[model samples]
Target chain A: MDRATTETKLINGYQHEFPLVPRPFQRIGESLGMDEDEVLALLRDLQDRGALARIGAVVSPRTIGTSTLAAMTVPPDRLEDVAALVSAFPEVNHNYEREHDINLWFVVAAPSENDVATVLHNIERRTGLEVIGLPMLDSYHIDLGFRLPCG
Target chain B: MNRIAPSPAIDDLDRRIVKATQSGLPLVPRPYHALAETLGVTPEQIMDRMRRLLAKGIIRRIGAVPNHYRLGYTANGMSVWDVDDAAVAETGAAMGQLDFVSHCYHRPRQLPIWPYNLFAMVHGRSREEVEAKVKKIAALLGDREDGHDILYSTRILKKTGLRLVD
Candidate 1:
């Protein structure tokens, strides 16, 4: 199979529900009509090409720390500095500037709610922008895995 | 601040397993053995703990994470909706069921400037594609959705998490 075909297979078939078996590669290869070696090679190549992010457990947030979605609206001139400052925080993961007046959005995870409060407060104090902490009230959908459309 | 429920069951060894597998597991014949050796535990012990982790819902799935940007679904949209608080779960679940929405969450609806309570991540080949998918979510939400906005990522600074595990 070509690289494109392999890529599609790996993305769609394995993105979610990776076999929990010890010999997962062998099982995946068997399903794909390839050997365990071929499966491993394909996966490694995909990683090298930056198509596959990782083959690992997607840990649920809040297991070890508390996290909340936060946003800050900055003046156009201060966007860069504010974004940089927010991104600098180790707790702020998935930082992005989206198309809206309330532009910057990110998730901050810390060991406790107190730490989260401190982080948000620090960001507010540092950036001079009110950090709106919108913690999750409920989870309608938890898993973030999306399948690549099959050819 | 939302009070986080303590998960005291996750002990030191569990932390080690999460640290080991967060990046990924091995791709060899005896992947569990490799992890066990690294963590100074028996293969069976690792396997048993991993199984418990899966059962306990600590691990979403043992899987491959794909980069949608590289996969040609270039347009990524963070679609947020202000739905009636009481009906959020039903509406959010419906939106989550949509194939294009990678994640759907019932976040708080901050007053004044921020009013969106439901967040769904929609992705497509182009901006238009993502917008179309968002519309489908809106339609599914119907009258329950008060207002909605799609925030296409201007810049993605970071997308992975390590703080919680480490």
Candidate 2:
């Protein structure tokens, strides 16, 4: 396979069911007919380009820690500033400006619920905007990962 | 909010492993071996623990998390729906079966201000495509879909994965 084809396979094939062996990359390379070093280099390139987040386990939500989907209605003029403040908290991950009255959306994850509450309270106090906490009541989807269209 | 039953099998070592690799595994030939060194465990032990975690569903999957935007999935919409409380479970489960719906969840509504309870993330190459998919969801809900709105993320101020706090 050529470079682009190889890259596509590396992504589409290994999104799930990645080998758990000690030399997993080696196994992957063997399957792709490339050496271990080549596979590692390709993965590094993908990471550098932000194409791949990581090659690791996607932990289930609220399994190791508690988290909630929080949103805030920041005035249009203060959107950027408020977003920066919200994103500053280490607990605030995956923050985005959605198109809605409650525009600033983010996820606050912490080892404990108390820690999560502290972050939310601090954000509310600093921004002077009410944070709407929409915690997940239940999850209906068990399957994760998108099925990429093959090139 | 629904509370998940804490797995009795997870221990401090598992937490340590999660903290180490929640972002990602090392991009090396022997990734697990490198992780074992970092966590002060043998490669076999690390691999064993990971296997068990996967079995227990603590770890959803161990592989590449592709950047959706980079993959040409730019039109991402958070489709929110106000379904009847009695039928949300059934509606959400069916919605999740749609190939276009990446994530479907039942979240509490904030009343008067926000009335949506079901959230489904729909991705497409264009907004039209996403809207069409949302239409399918609306049809799926039928009368159960009291009301709905799709929130398209305008800017990604922060894009880090969930990290475990110390």
Top TM-score: which candidate number? 2
In the predicted model 2, the residue pairs found to clash are none
User: What local distance difference test score does each model get?
Assistant: 0.80, 0.87
Summarize candidate 1's per-residue lDDT along A1-151 as a digit string, tens digits.
7867876887778867777667888988888888898888988888888788788888776766678899988898998888888888877877888888888889998878889999999999987789899987766666757776666
Q: Report the C-alpha lDDT of model 2 over A109-149, residue by residue, as the tens digit.
A: 98778888999999999988999899888888875677777
lDDT of model number 1:
0.80
Tens digits of per-residue lDDT, candidate 1, B23-48, equal 77776777888998998999888878
What residue runs in model 2 are displaced by over 4 Å at the alpha carbon? B1-3, B6-9
| Native-interface RMSD of candidate 1 | 3.4
Cα shift from native, residue A8, model 2 (Å): 2.5
Q: Which ten residues in a row have the lowest lDDT in candidate 2 chain A?
A: A142-151
| Lowest lDDT block of 10, candidate 1 chain B | B1-10
Backbone steric clashes in candidate 2, count: 0
| All candidates: TM-score | 0.92, 0.96
Q: Report how far off residue B101 is in candidate 1 (Å).
A: 1.5
The residue-by-residue lDDT of candidate 2 on B1-166, one tens digit each, is 2335553457999989988888899888788889989888998988889889888878888888888888788888999999999998888889988988888889999987999999999999999999999998888778888889999998889987767877
